[model samples]
Every structure is written in C-alpha cells, then in structure tokens.
Target: MAELQFREAIKQAIDEEMESDENVFIMGEEVAEYNGAYKVTEGLLDKYGFRRVIDTPISELGFAGIGVGAAMNGLRPIVEFMTFNFAVLAADQIINHASKARYMLGGQVSTPIVFRGANASAGQLGATHSVAYDSMYAMFPGLKVIYTSEPEDAKGLLKSAIRDDDPVLFMESEQMYGLKGEVTEEEDFTIPIGKGKIKREGDDVTVVATGKMYHIAQNAAKELAKDGVECEIIDPRTIKPLDIEMIIESIKKTNRCVVVDESHPFGGLASEVGFLIQREAFDYLDAPVQRVTLPDVNAPFSKPLFDLWLPDAKNVVEAVNTVTYRK
Candidate 1:
C-alpha cells in the first residue's frame, strides 16, 4: 500500500484503466488542457495525449450527448462534470439517452459511461454549486451511483465503474480531494459495487454514512467512544445499489441506527436507509432510526450559516445520543 491523496488515487485509477483499454477515454471541461477543475486529471493529458484525454467546451449538454454517442458506438467514456451541479444541463442525455439506451434499443447498445464530479458543499460554494444529487440520480433505473469516501475506495471503485456496462454516477467531494490515505499499488485493484465496509466496530449503535459525511461519522464515533458510547461506523461506499445488507447486519448487532448524509433531509440517502432498516430489520431495532442531514433549504453562502446548515459530527453525536437514550 502507498499513501496517496484522494485525487491522486482517482488519477491512478483513470490512468491505469486508459492504459489497459484502448476504448477507454476521458473528456470534460479543463480535463486535457487545464488538467481538471480539481486537478484530478493533472498530468493525464501529457501521459495519454490529446486524442484520449480530450477536453470539451463548457457545454454540459453538448459534450454529455457526445459521450453517450461514443458509449453507444463501443467506446467507454468517462465524462467529468466539474461538479454535479452542472450535470442538470445534461439530464436529457444522462437520464433519457445514456441510462435508457440499452432498454430503448432492445440491447443493441450499451452505455458504458461514467459521469463523475465533485458533490455537496465545498466551502461556501452557495446553493447553485452545493447540492448532493446522488439520491435523485439513484431514482433512475439504469444508473449505478457511487459516493466514495476514502482514497482507497475511490481508486478501486472508479476502476470498476469505468469497466461496467451500465452508466455510473461517480460523485466526489471538493473538500476531500487533498485528504490522504493508504491505497493499494496493485495494477488492477477493484472493489465490488454495492458493498459497504465497517470502518469502526462497536455494539452501542450503528452509524451509516457516505462520501464526506463518512468522515464526520468517524470523528463523531471517536468522540462518542470517549464518552463510553461505542459507535459502529459503516461507509456505504456505493449509494444506488446500496449495501443494505451490511447496514442491516450492523443494525441487528447494535439495535440502533443513525444515518448521516450530506444531502437534503427530504428524499436523501439517510431517508432511504432509515426506511430500509425499519422494513428489513424492524424487530431488531430498539429505537427509531435517526438521520443527520443538511437542512431542507438551499445551501447558505455565509460561513456560519453554512456550518449550521450542513450536517456535521455534532449533529451525528446528538442523533446517536438520542437513539441510545443518553439525551
């Protein structure tokens, strides 16, 4: 294993995939000439050249449709959105074409594409730039959504997504690009989609988190540990084909659950998890499932207001305390 930043791990995965498959190519704004909005594609243009690591104009719809066409014609395309907020403009291609092409064409075409970019809050980006649209995208039938938290998971899952036959919505965090963690140096490491990992094991309560919120859950678990509240933290690395079984197993063990997600409270990942828990493991639950999520309103521009608006360790700890009956 080698210590690598989250962005570095992603770069390695894309580089390795492009090296292995001639059909695999990456395209998006600033990807080729400017590296990437987050620099995840830094040095990739030089390594892969302009033909493979192509850059497009600032037209999400136009380029996204081009990617769908490429995927339909046998190429595997990785379309980076800069941020998923811009993906709204490409909804027609993503939802109507890229996702439904196989079914629409009676299996004559396959959209082996990965639409990836930063998600959720990234330090005062305001409402337009800070939405976590994973749950919304998960509503579509053909798309596989992944919200990775760590460097290792990011690398492995990205490699898998690039190779998958279906369209995958790969969401990252602008805040976590520089976070460092140990990642495997293997040339072909891949993590299965729809698998969750238990980051911390404890019997007191189960905390399910994804993406940036997973880090908050870890910090909250540590603080709760000091207070004699042993919290088990599970990262549902993939959001759409959620690893509900892992979460159910952890919930069965702990008998209490607190789901944390960066999305809005209504129709968020936490809501889906909470609903699934009650349905699949209701008898095992000792208390009602709690959720920690962003407020229902738009993301605030003010620092203090944004801090209050976004979900954090404090919110998680409080939810855990309430479920544990320590409040």
Candidate 2:
C-alpha cells in the first residue's frame, strides 16, 4: 500500500493501463504539453511520447468525436474535459454518439473510452463552471458513471473503467486532487463497478455520499457519533449502475437515511437514492429519508455565497439528525 494524492492515483491508473495496453492512449486539451489542466496527466507525455500522449485544441466536441472514432476502431482513448462543465459543449458526442454507438451498431463496435475530469463546484467557479452532471449523464442507458472519493477507489475504479467494453464517465473533484489516502500498489488492483462500500458502520442512520461529499458525510458522522448518534457512511462509487442494493441494505439495518450530494436537490443522486430506498426498503424505514444538497439554483461566484451553496458537514449533520429524529 502507498499513500498517494487523488490526482497521483488517477495518473497511476492511466499510466499503468497505457503501459500494459498498446491500444490505450490519452488525448485532450493541454494534456500533452501542459501536463493537463489539473496536472493529473503530468509526466505521461514524456513517458509515452507524443504519439501516445497527444494534445488537442480547445475544441471539446472535436476531440470527443475523435475519441469516439478511435474507440470504435479498437483503440482505448482517455478524453479529459478539464472540467465537466466544458463537456456540455460536447454533449452531442458524449450523450448521442459515444453512449449509443455500441447499441446502434448492434454490438459490432465497442466504445472502450473514458471521458473524465473535475465535476461540481470547485471553489467559486461560478454558475457556468460548477454544475454537477453525474445524474444527467447517468440517465443514459449505455454509459457507466463513476465518482470516486478516496485515492484507492480512484485508482482501482479507473483501471476497471479503462478496460471495460462500455464507455465510462469518470468524474473527479477539482477540490479533492490534493487529498491523500492509502492506495493499493498492486499491478492488477481493480474495483468492480456498481459496488458501494460502507466507509463507516453504525446502527442509527445511513449517510450516503459520493466524490468530495463522502468526506463531508464522514465528518458529519464523527460529530453524530459524539452525540450518541451512530451514522453509517456509504460511498456509492459508481453512480450510473447504482449500488442500490448496498444502500437499501444499510437503510434496512439503520432504518433511517440521509443522502449528501453536491448536485441540486431535484433529479440528482439524492433524489434518486431516496426514491430507491423507499421503493426497496419502505417497510423497514422508521422515518422519511432526508437529503443534504445544494439549493435548486446555479452556483454563485461570491466566496461566502459559494460556501453557503455547497453542501458540507453541517448540512449533512442536520439531515442525519432530521432522519434520525435527534432534532
């Protein structure tokens, strides 16, 4: 095991996969010469040379289309969008083309590609750049979506995503790139998609979170524990093929739940997870499910406003207290 930064772990996964597979290559804006906008692809260009570590112009749609075409022709391409906010410009390629190509071609082609970058709020980036699109992209049938919090999950899940036959949307938090955690150094370390892990166990309530929100949930859980409120933390690492079963089981054990998410309150992971819990474990629930999410509005640029807009430990603690009837 090795303690690695979140960005370093991601780079390790991509680096290892590319070294092992001749068909794997990386291409995106500033990826080669600039070492990636967030430096996640640092040193990759030197390691793999210009042929494998290619850079592109600031054209999300064009590069995305090229990645899709590469994938269809039996190449694995990792497409970094700098931030998912820019991915909106390439939604036609991501949602329509890359997502549906395999099915549209009757399984004749496999889009073994990964579209990844920072997601959600990254400290007052403003409305245009802080939108969370996990739920929106997860709605697609053929695309697999993953939002990892810890370095271990980041490394393992990314490896699996690169090798999977389906296209993957790997979301990271720009705020969490510096987070350090123990990650497996094994060559073939891989975590399966659609499997949720219980970060902490408790009997009072289940707090579900993903990406950076997981850390918020954990901090809230610690405070809750101090108050005799044991809260279980579950990280739904993969959002698209949601580990509904894991969350449901936790709810059945705890009989209460509080979902924490960075997305807006409506039609996001919180809404979907709350719905699934009710549907699958309604009889077991002792109280209504609560959610801690951003208000139904765009992210603000002001520092104070942005701080209030993003969900944090306080919001999660309040939601947990609500569901557990502690307040």
Candidate 3:
C-alpha cells in the first residue's frame, strides 16, 4: 500500500490506464498547458504529449460531443469538465447520445467514455454550481455513475471506469482533492462497480452515505459511538447499479438505517436507498428509515448560509438517533 492524496490517486489511475492502452486519451479545458483545473493531470501532458493529453476551447458541449464521437470510433476518451455543474451544456451528448447509442444500436457500438470532475458544493459556489447530479444521471439506463469518497476507492474505481465499455459519470469533490489515504500499489488495482463497502462496522444502526457525505457519516458514527449507539457506515461507491443488496443486508443486521446524501431531498440517493430498504428489509427493520440531505432549496452564496444548508455530522447524528429511537 502507498499513501497518496486523493488527486494523486486519480492521476495515477489515469496515468496507468493511458500507459496500458494506447487508445486511451484525456481531453478538456486546462488539461494540457494549464495542468488541469485541480492539477490532477499535472504531468500527464508532458508524459503523453499533446495528441493524447489535449486541451480544448471552453465549450463543454463541443468537446464532450467530440469525446463521444471519439469513443464511438474505438478510442477510449476521458472527458474532464472543470466542474460537473458545467456539464449541463453537454447533457444531450452524454445522456441522449453516449448513453443511448449502445442499447439503441443493440450492442453494435460501445461508448467507452469517462466524464469526470469536481462535483457538488465546494464552498459557497452558489446555486448553479452546487447542484449534485449523481441521482439525475443514475436514473438513466446505459450509463454508470461512480462517486468516490476515499483515495483508494477513487483510484481503483476510476481505473475500472476507464476500462468499462459504457459511458461513466465519475463524480469527485473539489474540497477532497487534498485528502490523503493509503492506496494499494498492486498492478491494475480495480474495485468493481455497484459494490458497497462497510466503511465502519457496527450493529446498532446502518448509515449509508457516498462522496462527501460519507465523511460526515463517519464523524456521526464516531459521535454516536460515545453514547453506545453504534452506527455502521456503508459507502455505495457506484450510484448506478447500486449495491442495494449490501445495504439491505446491513439493515437486517442493524434493524435501523440513516442515509446521508449531499443532493437535494427530492428523488435523491437517500430517497432511493430509503425506499429500497423498506421494500427489501422491511421485516427486519425496528424503526422507520431516516435521511439527512440538503433541503430542497438552491445553494446560497453566503458562507454562513451555505454552512447551514450543507448537511453535517450533527444532521447525520440526528437522523441516526431518529432511526435508532435514541433520545
């Protein structure tokens, strides 16, 4: 195992995949001469040259369409949007074209493309920039959504996403780029998609979270532990092809559940997970499943307001308490 920052792990994944496959290439704004918006592709341009490490005009729709076309022609392209909020401009290409091409054509064509970059609120970025599109993209078929929390999971899952023969929306956080964690140095390390991991084990309650919310759940779990309210934490690395079975099993053991999602409450990941838990593990549950999520309101630009709007450890703890029937 090797300790690396979250951004470094992502860079390593891209570097390894590109090294192994000549057809693999990455393109986006500031990805070449500017060394990427977050420096995730810092040295890749020099390592792979301009042909493979490309920089494009500030047009998400244009470059994203090019990436889809490239993938259709047998080139595996990694398209990076400076921020996923900007990706709305390319939704037609991603959702309509890349996602439908394979099924519509009956497997005759495969869009092996990866669209990735920072996601959700990074700190008072405001309403338009703070939206979490994970659930929205996951609702569609033929598209894979992977939102990673840890460095190791990011590296492993990203490598798998690059090699996957479908359109993958890889979500990351701008705030988590500096987080450090141990990642395996094994050759071709890849974590399977749609597999949820038990991040912290406990028997009192099951807490499901992903992306930035996973860390908040972790902190809540620690706090809950102090009062003998053991909270088990599950991180569903892939939002699509969700590892709901694993979550059901956990709820069976704990008999209580609390889901924390950074997205809005309406039709969010927590909503889906809550519904599934009730359907599959209803007999085993001791109390109603609870959720901690951003209220159905646009993100505010004010720092203090943003802090209030964002779900935190306290919010998760309260949800856990509700589910566990703790006073």
Candidate 4:
C-alpha cells in the first residue's frame, strides 16, 4: 500500500488506464495546457501528449457530446466537467444521448464513457454551484453513478468506471482533493461497482454515508463512542445500483440506521436508502431510520449561513443518537 492524496489517486487511475489502453483518452477545459482545474491532470498532457490529453473550449455541452460520440465509436473517453455545477449545461447529452444509446439501440452500442468532476458544496460556493447531482443522475437508467470518499476507493473505482461498457458519472468533492489515504500499489487495481464497504465496524447503529459525508459520519462515530454507541459506518461507493444488501446485513446486526448525505433531503440518496432500509430490513430495525442532509433550500453564500446549512459531524451525531434512542 502507498499513501496518496485523493487527487493523486485519481490521477494515478487515469494514468494507469491510459497507459494500458490506447483507446483511453481524456478531454475537458484546462485539462491539458492548464493542467486541469484542480491539477488532477497535471503532467498528464506531457506524459500522453496533446492527442490523448486534450483541452477543449469552455463549452461543456459541445465537449461532452464529442466524448459521447467518441465512446460510441470505440474510444474510451473521460470527460471532466470543471465542476458538475457546469455539467448542467450538458445534461441533454449525458442524460438523453449517452444514457439512452445503449438501451434504445437494443444493446447494439455501448457508451463506455466516464463523466467526472467535483460535486456538491465546497465551502462558500453558492446555490447554483453547490448542487449535489449524484441522486439526480442516479435516477436515470443506463447510467452508473460512483461517488468516492477515500483515496483508495477513488483510484480503484475510477479504473473500473473507465473499463465499464456503460456511461458512468463519477462524482468527487472539491474540498477532499487534499485528503491523504493509503492506496494499493497493485497493478491494474480496480474496485467493482455497486459494492459498499464497511469503513468502521460496530453493532449499536448502522451509519450509511457517501462521498464527503462519510468523513462527517466518521467524526460522529468517534464522538458517539464516548457514550458507548458503536456505529458501523458503511460507504456506498456507488450511488446507483446501491449496495443495499450490504446495508441490510449491517442493519440486521445493528437494528438502527442513520444516513448522512450532502444532497438535500427531498428525493435524495438518503431518502432512497431510508426507504430501502424500511422495506428490506423493516423487521430487523429497532427504530426509525434517521438522515442528516442539507435542508430543502439552496446553498447560502454567507459563511455563517452556509455553515448552518451544511450538514456536519454534529448533525450526523444527532441523527445517529436519534436512531439509537440515546440522550
């Protein structure tokens, strides 16, 4: 195992995949000459040359469409949106064309493309820029949604996303790029999609968290441990095709659940997970499932207001306590 920052793990994944597969290439604004918006593609332009490491105009829709076409024609393209907030401009291509091509054509064609970038609020980024699109994209069929929280998971899952024969929406966090974690040095490392990992083991309550929210859940778990509450934290690395079975297994052991998500409360990942827990593990549950998520309002730009709006460890701790019926 090797320690790598979250961004470095992502870069290593792309580097390894592109090195082995000539069909693999990457394109997005500032991806080449500018070394990527977050420097995740730094040095890739020189390593792979302009043909494979490409930079395009500031048009998300145009380049995204090109990426879909390239994938349909046999090239595996990784399309980066500076931030998913900007990807809203290209939703027509991603949701309509790329996602439907395989199904509508009766599996005659495979859109083996990966669309990735930072997602959700990164500090004071206001309403429009802070929207978490994980649940939104996961709702559509023919698309795979992977939101990673750890460096190792980011590296392994991305490699799988690139190799998948379907469209994948990979969501990362702007604030977590600097996070460091141990990643495997194994060659061709790839984690299977739709598999959830138990980050921490416990028996008192099951805490399901994803992306940046996983860290918040971790902090909450640590605090709860002081009062004898043990939380088994499960990170659903893939949002769509959720690993509900693993979650159900955890719930059977714990009999309580608290889902922490960065998305808003209504129609969010937490909503779906909470529903599934009640449906599949209803008999095992000892209490109602609780959720810690952004309220039903746009992100606030004001620092204090944003802090209030954002769900944090305190919020997760409260939710966990609620599910566990603790004071």
Candidate 5:
C-alpha cells in the first residue's frame, strides 16, 4: 500500500535492474555526481561509484552511440536523455544505427539498451523542447517504443525495456513524473510490451489514449458519464509492435472510438491506431474513428498559445461526443 511518484518508480526500476544484472550501467549528463536532471538517478553514484554511474558532457549523440556500442559489445547500458528533445542530436545513432544494426547485420548482434527519460510539452519549454517524437522513433524496424501513463506502468515497462534484448525508446512525460501512484516493492514485476490495457469499461464508445493524454481521456470520461455516455478507455502502452488487436477488439464492442494523444495530429499514434481500426474492424464501427490531439502547430512558449496546442478534457469530450453521434 505504499505510494511513489511516477519518476520515483522509474528510478526504482533502473536501480533494481542494475542490481539484478551486473552488465547493466547508466550514463548521461548529471547522472553520476548530480544524480540526474530530475533526480531519477539520485544516490546511484554513491552506491555504484563512477565506473557504472558515469557523467558525460552535454552530448546526447556521443553517449547514445556509446550505449549502442556497449550493447553490441556485451554490456547492457541504460542511456538517459535529460529530455528526449535533446536526443535530436543523437538521431543518427538512434534511428539509423541503433535501430537497424541488428537487422542490417543480419541478426548477428543484439542491442539490449534503453534510451529513455522525459518527453513532450511541459510549461514554457517552447517549440524546440515541447515536441514529442515517439512517432518518428517508433517507425524504425528493430526498436521498441514504450509510453506509460501511470506510475505502475512506468516502473514495469521501463524494467522490461531495460531487460529486453533490443533497443528500446522509453518515453516519459515531464508533467506526469511528479504524479503519485501505487507501485509494488517486488523487484521484477514487469508488464509485457506491445500490449494495451483497458482502464475503464463502457459500451457506448472507446477512447484510446497514450502517455499524458490517457489521464485527459479519463477526466473526459468521468464528465461524459454524468450525461449518460459510457466510455471505454484503452491505453496502448507501447507504440511499436502496438496492440492493434486489442484496439480492434475494443472498437468491435463500443462501435465508435476517439483516440487521444499528446502529439500533433499527422503521423501520430492516433493516426496509426485509426488506420488499424479502419483496416481490421471497419465493418464493426458504427461511426468513423476520430482523433483528439494537439493542433498541428509548433508548441509555443506563450501560455495561451501552448494551451491551444495541447489536447485537453474539453477537446476529448467533444471528440467522443462527435464519434458517438451524441451531438
């Protein structure tokens, strides 16, 4: 019955994973002596020393490539990006090399590494920092994309990502890191990748959300329920090898769906989920699958402009109402 912040759970997962596997080591800026930008790696340096908990210069590209190289050479490295936006500097190593190395090498090497930490809009962080790139990264061949919306899911999936034998992109929302939830003290209780979890049950409509948008969809659901509309909410925890089958099944029962995501509308997770539902369960859908996402604009620094670009409860409620033909 103990409670932990979502960020704390993430720290716990990485800490335990390192203890369980001697091959595991962590590297990033402020990770060793400073504990980490968000304190997720706090006390690691004191426990493991500089050999394992390394502090690098502000070079995401260099460190990420080093992690990739380590994974190839038989060590398991967890590369933490201060924020995924900074990871843009490491795109080549991440998308071209780390993602395709195993397949390009004809399945000879395994990249058992985790590239993770905060992603998406948070406060006045502005255009360059606020954009979420899960869609861009998830498009790769040999990569696993993880998007957890809760504390428990964050801990379990992050642990699985670290232990898996392929390169994993574990995205965390900066806003959700401080939110508290229940997490088990067990060492390795992991949630399977490429699966969807149903958070709420309903017969009228399905609202599929990922990352921070999952909480928005849940808030909208509570409001809609007061007006006699029941909503089934599904969270596709991992984007690549996505749980499309679960979405197809949910749409079949609800007959209508509104996918909510924190990213822009085009080429986003919602777009992919919508296309999947159209292909597999088109006959079952009573209405078209609508998406609730940020407007296709660069996230602005101004408070009002940023709010306009972010998806919220009002938009989610409207999207569901439109899809369910409720006017």
Candidate 6:
C-alpha cells in the first residue's frame, strides 16, 4: 500500500534481498559509492558495505564472468550494465557461458545470477545505445528472462528472479525508472516466471504486451474504447516459457489478437506470439493476428524518428483495427 517510484521499488527489492540473503551481492558499473548509473543502487553501498555492493570497471565481460563464476560457487550476484546496449561486450559471457553453463555441465551446477539494467530506447540515447533486446536474449534456452512494465511489477519480478536457482535476465526500461506506482508492503510477494496477467478484459481483441509496451497498450486500449472498440491487454511478463496457454485462452474468447511489442517484428516477441497463436489457436481466430512493432532497422537518434520506430498508441489502435477487420 506504499507509493514508490520505479527506481525506489527496485532499490528496495535489491536492499531487501541482500539483507535477507548474505549470499546475494551486487556488482555493476558505479554501483558502489557512485550509486549505479541510474541510481538504482543508491545508498546500497553504505547500507550493505562495499564488499557486497561493488563498483566494477567498465568491463562488462569481466564483471559478467565474475558474477557467473560466483553464482556457480554458491553466491547470488546481481550484475548490472549501464544500459543493455553496452551488454554486447559481455555477450560471450552471457550467451555462450552464463546462459549455457548449467546445461553444458549436466545440471550439476546452478547459477543464481541476475544480469539486469535498462533495455530499450531512452530519449536521445541514439542507435548505438537504444533498442529493446530482451527478445534477443530469449534465443538462449538456459537463461530465464523477466521484464516488467511497471514499478510494482518490476520490484516483484526482480525479487523473484534474484531468488531463482538459474541465471536470470531482468530487462528494465530506463524511461520507466522515474515513474511511480503503489508497491505492495509485503516482502513475501513474488511473481512467477511463466504467467500472464490480463490488465483489462475485453471481447473484440487481445493485445499481448511486455515490459514498457504494456503501459502503451493500456493507453491504446483506453483510446480504442472511445471508438467503441474493446481491447484486452495481457502482459506475458516473462518472455521465455511464455504463457502460451493463457494467450490461447484469451484468443479463443476474443477470436482476434494484436501483439504490441517494442522489439522489431522479425524474430522478436511479436513473431513469437504470432507463431504460438497460429499453431495453437488458428482455428479460433476470426481474423489474422496483427503485430505492432518497431521497424526492423537500428533505433534512430532523432526524437521524431525514435517516436516513429517505437510502438505507440497510434500503432496499437491501427493493429486493433486491422485484427478486427476495420480500416
């Protein structure tokens, strides 16, 4: 019943998890005395001390490797990147190593590691630093991905990810960090990894969204309501091991679906949802599944261009119309 900004809720999640589990520690760029690049780690160094809240050099691979190795050795490590764009430098460690090590070793080892921080276009951050890549991370089977679109869900999801027995990728949006929402006062609150929650119930169409796009879909549903179009907004919450059953159930009821995601249409969340829908619920669809996604090009630097590239209310409305057989 407490109101907290996205960043505050995240900070509380990390602080609480670390205090309760001595094996859990944070290692990231500027996480120590500097209090993290986004200040998500603010005041943590003083409370937990430097050893537990380490500020690493600008070496994503080095720190990521250390975190994975530590997790294998029985410590829970939260490794943060300044932004996920910079995580490319650590891909070898994340994709080939951290993501596959457990399976490669025949399940003899468990990596309780959480690689987190901002993902997606943040203002004028440009092509090099912008773009949502949680969908990209889903290619690795051993990695569990958790992305939340709100402050409260972010806290609940991140806490769940950190406490899990496997490697987790907690994708967040830098733009949503300052946003505020009422977070629960309960410490035992933890969201499951492969569940979907319908934020709105409607009959005309189902809009499946994740991360920051969930809020955009909510707004789009509101706008569509004005035009006498009903939209059901569902958040997959966790991309991998996706709640395909829940989505199928929704589509079976609505007979139409529109997927809204910030990632590109090709080989992204949109495509995955579309694939699942056709495979499991094609007979139930009244119209084709329409996906509103970013253009399959690098994220642009210009503000207007950036706006055009990301999923928005206009795109959602258009997709809703498309799937509902409207112009």
Scored against the true structure, residue 175 in model 5 reaches a CA lDDT of 90
lDDT of 2 by residue, 1-327 (tens): 899999999999999999999999999999999999999999999999999998999999999999999999999999999999999999999899999998998989889999999998888677999988999999998999999999999999999999999899999999999999999778789999889899998999988999899999998888888899998899999998999999988887999988888899889999999888888899999999998889998888999888888888998888887887778
| Poorest lDDT segment (10 consecutive residues) of candidate 5 | 183-192
Q: How close to the true structure is residue 170 of candidate 2, measured as C-alpha lDDT?
A: 98
| lDDT per residue (tens digit) for residues 1-327 in model 5 | 469998899999998998999999999999889889888999999999899999999988899999999999999999999999999999999988888988889889998999998888878987899988898898878889998999999999988898899999999999988999998877568999988899999999989998999999999999999999999999999988799888888888999999998888899988998898899999999999999888878888989877877889999999888987777
Error of 1 at 257 (Å): 0.2
RMSD of 3: 0.7
| lDDT tens per residue, model 3, 73-97 | 9999999999999999999999999
lDDT of each: 0.94, 0.92, 0.94, 0.95, 0.90, 0.89
Better of 2 and 4 by lDDT: 4
What's the true lDDT of residue 32 in model 5? Answer: 88
lDDT of 3 at 14: 99
Clashing pairs in 4: none
lDDT of 4 by residue, 154-214 (tens): 9999999999999999999999999999999888889999999998999999999999999
Worst 10 residues of 1 by lDDT: 118-127
Could you give me the TM-score of model 4 versus the true structure? 0.99
Error of 1 at 10 (Å): 0.3
For residue 85, model 1's alpha carbon misses the true position, in angstroms, by 0.4
Each model's total of backbone clashes = 0, 0, 0, 0, 0, 0
Give lDDT tens digits, candidate 6, residues 11-57.
Answer: 98898899899999999889998888888999999898988999899
Which candidate number maximizes lDDT?
4
